[model samples]
Target: MSGQNAKPEATPGVRQFTVAPDDDGIRLDRWFKRHLPQVGFGMVSRWARTGQVRVDGKRVKPEDRLAAGQVLRVPPGGESDRPKPQRRQLSQDEIDRAEAMLIARTDAALVLNKPPGLSTQGGTKTTQHVDGLLDAYAGDDEPRPRLVHRLDKDTSGVLLVARTPGSAAFFSKRFSGRSAKKIYWALVVGVPDLAEGEIDAPLAKQPGTGGEKMHVDEENGQPARTLYRVLDRAGNRAAWVELQPMTGRTHQLRVHLAAIGHPIVGDGKYGGQDAFLTGTISRKMHLHARRLIIDAPKDSRGGGGKLDVTAELPDHFAASLEQLGFDAGMSDARPVAEPPRERTPQEKKQAARQHARQYRKARRGERRTRGAPKPDKPGKR
Candidate 1:
């Protein structure tokens, strides 16, 4: 139990630079967006929101005007704000197989399933991520594609990527207007009293730490809405739930679930419990991206119904459900590689404690011997 809350040291990085001219007094976020053309504006907004992108060793607001020569530290592990040389790695055969999941493809867009634990893009100093293998996924397409939205590092589900700049603009507009429906499945700590209800808690970035959490901010927060329903009850301690996010704020579902007193188990950051370490079911939040419904661009030649894409539970989630009584080989969207499971020494210690408790109970039962001695004593008396 000791030191369970300790966070490791920050990832190491060195200073990098892109100078802002005197005339570039534009919003700090906007300025970064322009100067760092490769990085997404939202990534910059996130850094500003979280205080990672600071000015003069202090945090700067998104719209804060920039003064020339203010020192900035670009942290390690950003997918968007990093630069690297181009190279080819995967063979042609590998590229074909990975692209087989394409539900819809055009010169401008291609919607695909993004497996859990795959970062949307590569980092400044990263070894492997979803974006790291773009050569295999994107095939021979020049200039490649870009991710429009990101699932959490451990969330397995549908991800939308735009193949062209024009398509990227189209998809971005749809997302901004909330025209897309994002549905998810999460196994939570306990069942809610209501079968179906909406949680309309405003969420603000968790205080004290930057970008680490989202808390229920009654005041000084942005509007966020999440619609949820109990899918099925799991014994007494947990329940399977469905989530429909009305707003796409970071950690919105995780925060809303926590605010209502039912944090997603194994979600140590927001769910904040280390209980899942005991069973083979490590990382038990059980949240799956499940499905996404978005309005595909009306064809340049004509038009039709909205585009739908679904990514099934990766192997780990599937295995967990089977262990918990979900039917084996049940219907799912897609099959993905599972996260590697490891048994930590701490988990072994917890298991040992359980065995000791069972041993003591057995010893007590042996001593009682039901009515064996009691009857003889009564007769003697």
Candidate 2:
């Protein structure tokens, strides 16, 4: 609250505030709004222009990002005792449905096993979405939970929600920094040629798909990479695959798989008629957000606050796995452990020299034993 212009007269003077870890990589204006909720955007803009607000003794714009440990100079007295908007009332049915989806909850986070049909955020025609249902998780005076990431509609699995704005900022930074790990399980129409590999294709939105479809556009596309491993196979007809997308692009996994000729089952948008399999297999999308691993809030218990959460397979996806004779729990879809780092040239040379010296020492010891300690020709000694 030090940087906040709350009650400028309460403490009339310039104040220096150190940015907290939660505020790393946040915009200057947002930092003021969070810590100094009373500070208006107009005031922040004026201060930035006149050099009243500075970050680390340097004048910064309202859009400048702030890093942890940076000192923020605050000029007080723009505090506005603005009341928050009234909490939106949610229907009992909506509340019940959302509560039933709760998989895990903590002081700073909420992990939900979002159902396949539920949209993460609302859209033009989307009357009901997870964003509208988040009010169900709010406490009496707590701020509404904020979504940290998005899962595609029909992609069932673990969706993270931040309990407060501070935690939201922290989790957002982790995601943008690529420190968070996400693993998705999907059933594809056919097995890939390789058991495991990386897809480093770039993707761009298609010309006209309502911004819902993507295509691999080598000429002009954003860089996207996905690491995939075939977990199990039902002959060459279908395969269970684990996907880890390094970059968060719209429909990256689906587009990449389709581009590789192994489009995900039930993904007709990209795969066409070949996406679905006839018979007992359902025609629903088989992709499910299976697991997420990221750092927990600093206050969490156990092992420096590591947060690892996994979502169970959705009903249709689970049934597909069973139908294909694949064990739902057999593959955890964890990434392969990184190999040991290669030694530098200098270090390699030093090791070789050390080995050679050890070998020479062993040979000398053997020679000494043969020359001097022959036990005096057995009985002659």
Candidate 3:
């Protein structure tokens, strides 16, 4: 609840905070999370991680103990508020209820069935985020494991976390290298023509100030690849689809689907009129980060070798299956289609021009047949 009601706005953009008498020696991130839960520790950590969170105008680690009169400045960290684990506003009972769903954990990571509306992390002035309750999630570790990747703040399902920097670094590298394959379950606004296929389009950040707003440049953006197969189509209105993001980009799957005009439900930002959050749809933003498979980096501790971990779909995601018409309990979410080689700009242009020429020929033939009599009028003489 990023202090939803707090008027003590964090310095807009990037503001610096000075350690005060009441805040001495506390971990910088903890202190800030106490004051700014909405801004999230991901922001805090990225700054601190990169020596951007400065103390006395000097960068310090988020774990560094803060002394009184210390000044900390948060550098600009792009637009997507880096995530952190934040404490939720759930009560003791609510917390207890939410516990049965801890789906997976390992020495290197933990995954949770993040419920819709629960944020992954909190910020200074934010009261509760996944990080706010270190005692609960971090366990015996002095500092809790940080998030390696994030589900959208409102999305629910297998959200992964890294227990230590060694693991975080391992997975982070793997994520950057595209070694992790992600599969998602989503109910989209309408049925697609091809039952199973690929959406090869360039996705560029929407050129304005908003988180997660991206566009299908199909032309100028970075190459983003997504492969989706229609699992079930409930008439002309909706389809249950499984998506594999062959390339990792922010909202790649969402953008790809929407570019084809079948936006996912509940994706308020990019799903356009089909966003379930908006009036055009009624289903829960039918999207889930249903599965994650990582070819775990070779164990650095035990002579580099490969390790792989896989997460099955959570219940809600599976339940989404029954609604959308799949064998609700099957564990496999992999797409059946092979990805096509992406056409380069020149090739795509050539194809388009070719299509246009064909279209013009067709139109010309139609005009010659349909409009010829009106034009000649037999010379009307």
What's the CA RMSD for each of the models?
17.5, 19.1, 13.8
Against the reference, the lDDT scores of all candidates come to 0.62, 0.81, 0.63
lDDT of 3: 0.63
Model 2: per-residue Cα lDDT over 281-302, one tens digit each: 9999999998888887653222
Q: Name the runs in model 1 displaced over 4 angstroms.
A: 1-108, 139-143, 274-278, 300-304, 327-381
Which is the better candidate, 1 or 2, if ranked by lDDT? Answer: 2
Model 2: which residue pairs collide?
4-36, 8-77
Stretches of candidate 2 above 4 Å error? 1-32, 35-38, 41-83, 300-304, 333-381
TM-scores for candidates 1 onward, in order: 0.59, 0.73, 0.59
Can you write out model 1's per-residue Cα lDDT over 1-381, one digit (the tens) per residue? Answer: 110111233446634443333212456665555444565777777877897777666887878876544565555555654664466676565465357545566545676666666556666665555555555545543446677888777676777887644456667878999888888887777677777766666667877887677776655667677778776666766666778888888888887776665767678776555225346765745677777777775443345257776776767777766666655233333332122243365653454344334434544554676535645666575
Tell me which of candidates 1 and 2 scores higher on TM-score: 2
Given candidate 2, what's the lDDT at residue 199? 71
Leading candidate by TM-score:
2
184: Cα error in model 1, Å: 0.6
Best-performing candidate as measured by lDDT: 2
Error of 1 at 287 (Å): 1.6
Please count the clashing residue pairs in each candidate, in the order shown: 1, 2, 29
**Models ranked on TM-score:** 2, 1, 3
